[model samples]
Target: MNMVQLERMKNDKGFIAALDQSGGSTPKALGLYGIAKETYTDESEMIQLMHEMRSRIMESPAFTKERILAAILFEKTMDLKVAGKYSADYLWENKGILSILKVDKGLLDLQDGVQLMKPIPKLDELLVRAKDRHIFGTKMRSVIKEANEVGIKAIVDQQFEIGAVISAAGFIPILEPEVDIHTPNKEVAEAILKKELIEHLKNLDPTYQVMLKVTIPDIDNFYEELMNYPNVVRVVALSGGYPREEANEKLKKNHNLIASFSRALTEGLNVNQSDEAFNHMLDQSIQSIYEASI
Candidate 1:
């Protein structure tokens, strides 16, 4: 649950599959399979659909072969049951896929196209449940669209503050301060983000290691320092809506970070495909992502 546990998980050298879609994102992910939002008019029905989708994925060779070392799960998927067993247990016992919980309560809008993760009420209680469930770590998202110094600093401070809380409760915190790929000033944003992150990490206790999930930088060597930071277990990239091939190409050029991609990882996969076809598509995808990661 802490750095020791996270370091053990990292020894496996495989990418993390992020399937932690929630609320509107959940239905959007389902739509990839021609599933309509109306099919799940209630929360319970939606959860069932998500559970079924995850069950099929976990049963595949992509998982069984250990191509995916970890999976980031939405709250519903984190608690999902398969054959009367918690899905996390099923994956860990059967396939060596460690489970991670997405603890952010979604995003709240701020000005200038910036957003902060909604505060989780009773977050301490959530961490306790996650620890009991054997979840490996936690991930949350905050975004920077256009970097104003004040806004960027605030984003960095808030993330580390929450990250510290999560780490103290014995979870490896993945602090995601996503610089939107579409921003015209992505280079500047990455510069500012890198500076702020280093300052914050310097102040962090050396005992608590953390992870960072950020947008692929547009400039070369933009994150060199942070990538090699001693307390950073891994620096992972988010797809941020890129297609699988494009993301892979960009990822291949980066030497120090691996991926925790969601949409890009699932781009060629489809629910209507036969199991064999699904496996083939997924295997190819995982192989490419794996290659890029290393």
Candidate 2:
């Protein structure tokens, strides 16, 4: 929390030496634009940088959330119990995230495509504690149904869909800027690079539209293949080294890493959880998109 201490240690290359020291968290898209003034707009290079950081994370034994917080947060030997339920009466706090809760009544695609949504914190086991704050889900269903009313088709995370036939899914294909692809040894992938992973992941997504994280060498080697995906929308920092839509200018200044809003807009609506405001926003964005689209 102390900027002074952080600044002091930042000079010690050895401190962060264990991780992807090659690329610092990265200047945000806006910040990059501000600094580069030019040349930073090259997305190919930024893609490589993302893989570099991912490799570092995968290679480090110390950074894993399990290992890093093992001492207390989820101590291997301690009780993992927290108790409360929504069976009792509940009241609205009105206090919520997002200054304005925008409603997106976007037209949904009833076409049975694998509409990939963002992963929710609901890990299938624990009941979300923030049930009182559930608002997004109600909105999403309405949108999906609305999409159905139109002739547009859609589906959720399907195996395959082709051409404009894939257009009606009520979801936009989002991009994942980076992914952790450790080798069989669970270390940084050396013999195999980003390409192999991309090649391999290319098949994993039933929808065929996915954000891939592969090594740089892989991208370099399989440049043709990566560039050739029919529906892939490569992850680009919406505000980073280049303009999201333009892709021809420097990122804005002094910013560090941030999620791509365009990607998140679609990823966010996939689920609803009691505590996450982003999830609700995604949901509403989906609706808003549909409403506006229709």
lDDT of each: 0.81, 0.24
Best by lDDT: 1
lDDT (0-100) at residue 108 of candidate 1? 82
Model 1 Cα RMSD, 1 decimal: 1.7
Model 1: residues >4 Å from true position, as ranges? Answer: 2-5
The sequence of per-residue lDDT tens digits that candidate 1 reaches over residues 10-63 is 565778899888877878888885578887789778878877887777778776
Please give the distance, in angstroms, between residue 275's alpha carbon in candidate 2 and its true position after superposition: 35
Tens digit per residue, CA lDDT, model 2, 1-294: 223322322221110101111122233422322233243566546544433332322223322221111010111101111122111111011111101011121223323211232222332111122122221111111111111212112222221222122223222222222222222321223223233435444664455443222222222233335544544433222221222222111212212211222222222222122325533443454333222211
Q: What is the alpha-carbon lDDT for the whole of candidate 2?
A: 0.24
> TM-score of predicted model 1?
0.95
Top model number, TM-score: 1
Show the lowest summed lDDT stretch of 10 residues, model 2. Answer: 69-78
lDDT of 1 at 7: 59
